[model samples]
Target: MIRGIRGAVTVTENHAEDMIQETKRLIETMAEKNQIAPEDIASVFISITNDLNATFPAKALRLIDGWKYVPVMCMPEIDVPGGLEKCIRVMMTVNTSLGQKDVNHIYLNDAIQLRPDLMKEE
Candidate 1:
């Protein structure tokens, strides 16, 4: 069986390097917390807010991880009322034995407000 974990990241710059580095950091954090091996990732979809257009966040992760076979795509998030800008959202489906309660979803930076109850407060 498998489960999905959702995460969001805020990029400091629109450069491919920044997007990739931040995404890499976020994914590493999520996987570590949930005990999810990179090989367990079934697929990953990332969406960046409309404000960012310089690079695709997905490219950053795939390049960094060398997970060329893992299905990854990046799209622009539609601008909506009260939506956060410069945000990169990731939805990863993983084939794992972990139960739902054990899965850890991440919400970072301004995106933390999107899921206050689940956000890890420090």
Candidate 2:
């Protein structure tokens, strides 16, 4: 069966380079924790908050994940009435035999603010 994993992270500042680095770091950490295989990756979708207009987060993943075969798409996040800023969210599906219980979801940096409960123990 296929499993879905999600992770979110934010740039330290508003810098494009920082966003790229943080996004790559969070994905790598999640992938390692979940033991993702390149061949098992179905695809990845990423969204950047309306405030961010720099490099796409998916570019960093393509450059760092070493999974040139997997599909990745990036887009600007919608500006909801009340929403987070300078945030990048990722959703990925992997072709895995493991169940959802075995998946690891990550929330890093300021993005953790979006999930205070998850960060309380960190």
Question: How close is every model to the real structure, measured as TM-score?
Answer: 0.87, 0.87
**Tens-digit lDDT string for candidate 2 (1-122):** 78888889877567778888888898887788778877888999999998887777777777664688878999888889678778999988988777776667788877777765544232
lDDT of 2 at 80: 91
Clashing pairs in 1: none
Global lDDT of each candidate: 0.80, 0.80
Name model 1 segments beyond 4 Å from true. Answer: 120-122
- Tens digits of per-residue lDDT, candidate 1, 18-120, equal 7778888887787877877768889998998888888777776665454667788888788897888788999999988888866789987777777777765
Residue 16, candidate 2: alpha-carbon lDDT: 77
**Whole-structure CA lDDT of model 1:** 0.80
Span of ten consecutive residues with least summed lDDT in model 1: 59-68
